[model samples]
Target: MISRRLGSIAIGLALLGGTGANALLAPSAEADATTSRTYESLKNGSFEADAGWSSFAQGAGTEAAVSDLRASHGQRSLRIVDSSSSSAVGWASNAIRVDPGKQYTATALSYVASGHAPLLYLKFYDSAGRELDSTATSASTQRGEWRAFPAVSAWAPDGATHAQVVIYSLSNRTGTFFVDAVDLAPGANASLTANQYFHVQNDGSATPWGWYELDDARQAGSVVPDPTDAANGVLAIRPHVSTGDEWSGAVGTRFSASEAARYSLSMKALRQRGTPVMHAALRYYDRHGEVIGTDRSGIDVVPGRWQESSLTSLAPSGTVEAELIIGCTGTVRCDTLVDDVTVTPHWDTTFYAAPSALGSADGSTPESAADYRDDAFWQEVDAALETGTARVVLTDGQYDVATDDDALHLRGIGSDDHRLLVSGESRFGVVLTQRADLTTYVVQVRDVVNLTVENIHLTADGTYVTPSAFLITEDPTAGERTEGIIVRGISLTDMPGVKYSGVGVAGTVPSGPGVVDVVVDDGLFARGGSGAGYHHVYATRGATTVRVSESVLQDSAGTYVKLRDNVGDWVIEDNIFVSSGTWINNVQFIQWALYNTTEPGNEFFSPGPYRIAGNVFEAQEGWCAPQCRVMTLTARGYNPVDHDGVEWDHLLDPVKREILMDESEGNIETRRAVVRQNFNLALDDAHGISVTDNEYRNIDTLMTLWNTSDYGAPSQGGNGVYDLSNLFATYRDGL
Candidate 1:
């Protein structure tokens, strides 16, 4: 099962309000038909009304006022001046009624003329005047220029009855900042736009891009020159061992899916060497990252000739995604070549769309395919969902959602029960293009039960505006999260603005349930943002049980996958991480910061069952002058008082460290992981963790595992090891 072979350990992982004219406004011109784009902008959203907002200052020399010094989209802005050594200053809007469980995105423009970063918060309160919950965005980082401040997207908790938008900063130094165009809209930014748009275009080709070694180095798989035709390359699955597991020699790709549905699986394979028993199978997974069941090829292969195998089977119950495998098992040396692998919808209501097909199209077939550029296409999709699951099959062509304004190409699947599948002929066969900036996503999902976007290419020409290719998010209430989603078999290129995915899960609260049961498989995430915080796949604030496998991730400015704080139960396996690009903070290939940074005791503790097995980490020589690390499992925090008097030197003291672990339940940092059977090339070492049964080549130090808790410092002691081995890496000592 997936739990055994694929390394998946099952893990369990809005907004409000109302008002009249000031509380509810008409939909703007940019709002799409399906979106409840009607939003309640605070009476003083533009700071034009002097009486609707209350100003507060906590220090002697700090003050707030409506000033004409600068504005973004208005004649005036809220200015907070802190002339004292320490102060809290800003304006708070009157509380507005909100839906108890809906998400709201708090946005504003800020000019941090000097001093520290600004802060934006959406504070939720219950009907009894008691605070329920509050969420904040990243501190505003831009200075001088009037730029969009960080987002404070969050859900109104179960008891919340009102929400107040607070724009302020608690600074310890003298500074000034201006804020304008503030609004708290109900839903994510991408949820307010058209729900049927794509971001990049590709020259529809049947063959996908970026397939790499499947088994790390055991039974290698790569795109090698075709044995039949040297000029062309084919996927070569070479089984080095004569015999092993039933699914040993394999080449595979993964994609997101829905449960209890039949999928059409097919592939062309040729035996280039030994008479190995060719095998093809489909491994299905639940949103919890656990393997549910599998389906295999029904017919046997005819050796020494190209043969095609196809099968139809129902996906096991609870399956949200699946991997398509092509390979062989043998008692002797074997080599197999594969091509034209595909998995398409079999029982869902299917529609066809093509770029050039227009004129009263019905989307019944390719000849009558709906024109993707027309409103009718979206209407067609929106209508189909009123009944059951729907599949939109796109013909090979470029589908661009071009808009002149900064408005996002927000597309969401509307149903909470039925699934929606948007499939292309191949990963490079169909393309989705968006002309908007980084604030937008190629595909954004919120509150959907099951949705899959696969076999397509997403690109941004040179626009560094889109931060992710696919983003699954929701500011969910307690005990709820956006779940059962997949993004598979696609290519993301020239996406310099993407700080998250090829596929990312964002906007989750550390206190609330986060996005879970998500899978990102068989895609190419390359040449992305080189910014300090940018990464290929980023799961933040309680996201857990996510599986990222069988894909190529290359040239990230930062690391490939970043599970930042309170994320756990991630299965990252059988993928290739190629580091040959601009290096800003390329410190770790896959970093897991899985401990609670602010919470005391074990309230918000989330260590891990993080499985990092059967993968390859490769880097170019001199890419990171002193050499980069393969992976890191550390905390993004210092001593937070849970271990009151423990000093750096006392970390090694058994009694002291034991007290630290006991009081905190070892939640200060990443305390568990499985790092085995991996191939590290040109990687110098790992931090707070060691490896076993893994091959290393061209490494600087043979291998060094630090046993420290002070952010992987070599001089400190560790708390304990949480993996299967004797020494799991943590803060200060062994576990």
Candidate 2:
């Protein structure tokens, strides 16, 4: 049976029956004292099965089975009609049977009615039957409609039994295809809170009763569950948004609440027109998902009118649980439509809290530790985060935060494994010799809302100056600051061990309609973060949607993540940017700017389109500074006054000297980028970027000035060059 179910979960995963059948399919012991368990085994997942499933087609197609047509939930579907335009495997399925090594996950709810399936397998077989490992997902996981495909794994290797799903259909557009519901489980940990406890459901989380959907086919074009349609039952989902696509749409439900001050939600949106918008937001997370705040429901969604929209967000000051979201955007097709939803609580407990910060009663522990982190532990954590869902637990020591009050308040209370730590008197760490720079900030996260700071390790000899050491943006006297901040697995070392500057995480831009979403993952930003010449992780003016992933921005000295006069939405991926030391260009540790600072739309350089993927750069050829030009976008008159009379804020930076005190009023060059795949690199002085498929081992300069100079040198201009596909493995001097 698929090699006795891959002999039990792929004995070490290599195409199938993994890890000796997942250690002989371990789970027993009454399913580990049960807290959650679901082997699933397809009950027709959500298509509500009729024929359980048994389709086949092999080489050219004509048709297959199970079809009630349109469905991502409830109704029924599994159609496949490859009228053979040529190549084909069309469709195949004979599913069920997996446990060996136990780690399973296979899901499908795809939707693309006519033509499409440039490959969509999911195989597994063994036991005199060979083919033990397989997983494919093509057409870049499009979203013309129904979505939810991204999860495919197969470790049932050794003598692995059987499980299948084909559907290749090479061309002829691939012909008509549509699969629905289809899940094989066993692998719970979906963040257990007693498992699927979603509420406010009128059918919102359709699919099979549980809930999950996080679209991003290059930015929302589909989310699913709308199988066809519904406003309150039977089914409903589809959070698309376009402008062609950009971080796409959203559909949420994560639950848990507290730390209130406006967090209502009501949903039922609509849109075919009316400018496109379907929002009813609420993000606020923690326990490492970060995002401490995001609120909407300022209601929008008009056209086709289903109305009922109602939002209220603004829940910082220690928010508890969150994730409501239903966002959608605009421009391209828009289609926005969300359904029946309601949420309310925090009827104003007069900002309730305090009683050992509300400990016990199930927020698990915290009856009193006294050293909660200090400043009265944030005043009983801002009064137990003002009611409902609150928790605090950290035990190890070294916390000396005497609270200079950067406003991470807290107390709104919670219990989903929240934590806080500062650690012993720089014990040999923060040396100013213990008076430790009296606290300008080794950590300061303003406003607050679902903050998550995991696995900390601090160090700051940032020699009293740049509030280095993990300090995120905006506190302009509170006014709606901070937004879901998260700095994971940190390690800031100093005295050259690796590095740590005063700007491990310091973003500015937050005054005038706020926006912030900092996610510095897998952290380790060595060489004095944000201190020496600044930028291990820095942001200015537009700090919206900043996501520095799989981190490791070494020897910082001249930009490593600097966004000035910012706008937002940047995703610098799988990093490892190491340059011995040199700045003023070339190894320009990620920098983006328009007029340097001053956000609120229009004036050009509007935030992003940046998506510098899979990195591992070593853009050598050092000796930065003077006449600098390895990487720089100094438009708006590239000479804000060359060193002459140098007070120009050392060459402008108060938002570019306020756009150079209104340099004849004009600026907005909208930055854009998408430098792909990596390994060794040098994408210098790159403007309006776009360079695909890379493999630049090390210098000779890959691309130096794509958008060439500014012509007049003021905002965007002439051939800043765009478009350049499949960058035939590089070793270059020009584009």
Candidate 3:
């Protein structure tokens, strides 16, 4: 269903990282594995205090102050009101000391009611309080409503120190923009040593967060928190620049200052995303304040790469104190961060997330205003879709599909907590029933490039009249067809109260600039009653690849997956199918290839040279009637109804009213495929087919090579039966 849902299966890429909670914590020497940790460094950064900050505003209005105005998170946010009549003007903050090379993040929450007017940026300064460079957030505010802006970033330079955070309006744009929660800090942990690794250890040591900047061997830079680069925003040490010392960069605290015969050190460093020519140095000092060793090791890396550097050096006999120092020197003016610096006597090689910043533990989630089946729910869904790429999660419950036009539309779902959006202990929610008579499909994906839907379950309202729960159809107006789609971690079961089980087609894609890959993995599709294409998955549009693996199918009509045109594919392996129905196949591939229904004969698209292996096919012995064939390949150009007068054609009524399915013809050689390494005794019969290395049991037919060309005949091999991937390894014992 390239026009509808047929296409290649493309995996929706992973979502972004979790909040600070998702950040890594440095590992403790005593623990067997790395642990997660978080720390707060902002000093009155919440705008709750008036003494720590100097606020001002400029432009036509020329007014700014910390007020009890609408807050972004906590109470009392900073409000900047400007006028359009005046020239561009703004306010600035007093300089905060920072060490060169130690990367610091500057972050602030901003809100603009109108167009992309006022912009917020950061300014860095050296020892004498001279300006060094200006940096900005990843993207500028667009003309929109009130919402939070992305985190801004910056890195300090060597000889360069001190920074002033500022906000202002450029020409042609002047409006009210609010700023709150300004935070600055290092982005990660670069190494692990004696210093408690990012303040995460509770090993009876104070977190050496306090750092000092030195010019000519004396302390110089003032310390403040950098808020922009850390997730959303966090606190950091801002050391003053001392041009006097090439090493006048920011310096971290001394954990386990008591020296040893040998010392090993490591830490992570980075600058802005694309800045070039940046460097950092790690130094070691002996007792009596004497320099013993310094690592001028060349740091050749791109910005924001978080490159880790390690060095081991032997100390003098009298080494009483050791100071691990970090300095930055780069021709490129970009914001940098230094995190997870470690000094250890023992060299332990390993990788770990930054223990300093929080990782995936903010514990905040999008609050649901309404259930997923309501108009309010669709409105929320529509808003997320507008972002081009969005992350959405459906909580557990039974939802409804009213009118056919009201199917749920999806674009993208974020990475973290997509499944955790549930309130308590529910697997997923499903569209159970339809409110309107015109409603056929429960979910119809129209036009999108790459999409992923996972960790969700579908349930019916127990209404027997309901057709399918999910369907992807053609949109004549959409020039861009879907390329890749992944549907995983889903489940559909018979309802407790319903009379006739709900029947659903699950999904389909259109034909045009057809589909590339459609993957259905790790799901359960059971008893979607006895309708047409109402089993697991059915695709019409020709897909370059179609994959279904690691799933379970039970209590459904005979046919399971009917996705044709899966060219050159991985095995449809590791599945369990227990059915009692007397159908031609548990798996079938037919050429319904309809490129453009409005057109005549469409070009032939090869479905697959598929490898169907590693599965357990059990046609329950008690259900009666003739045993169903495990695999069937037909070269038919039209939908079939088992020739017998008894077997009904459930697809006729639905297709007749919708698309012109009768007008399209497919390639006669669409029956090409392979089946091997399966435990099923029932062999499929078709042209250009290969069924080999399988076990035969209480079944009739072994191979039925009937019509079609380019098929691989089944090869004979092993006779033992086993399930795929040991999903059923201990299954019988559990039973």
Best by lDDT: 1
Q: Candidates 1 and 2: which is better by lDDT?
A: 1
Alpha-carbon runs more than 4 Å astray in model 1: 1-258, 263-316, 320-345, 354-357, 371-388, 401-418, 434-438, 475-481, 510-512, 581-587, 594-607, 638-735
What's the true lDDT of residue 476 in model 1? 55
Off by over 4 Å in 2: 1-79, 83-102, 110-121, 124-177, 180-186, 189-448, 451-480, 483-517, 520-545, 548-571, 574-591, 596-634, 638-735
All candidates in order of lDDT, best leading: 1, 2, 3
TM-scores of the candidates are: 0.46, 0.30, 0.37
Instruction: Indicate the TM-score of model 3.
Output: 0.37
Per-residue error for 551 in candidate 3, Å, reads 0.7
lDDT of 1 at 528: 72
In order, what lDDT does every prediction score?
0.55, 0.43, 0.40
lDDT of 1 by residue, 512-600 (tens): 56676778876666667757567788887657667787666767777678776546567776565656434453545776554423323
Task: Estimate, for each residue in 416-521, the C-alpha lDDT of model 2 and write its tens digit.
Answer: 2222222222111121111244345546665564555544445433344335556665556545555656665454534222133434443444244454666777
Assess the local accuracy of residue 180 in candidate 1 as a C-alpha lDDT between 0 and 100: 77
lDDT of prediction 1 = 0.55
All-Cα superposition RMSD per candidate = 23.9, 26.8, 26.0
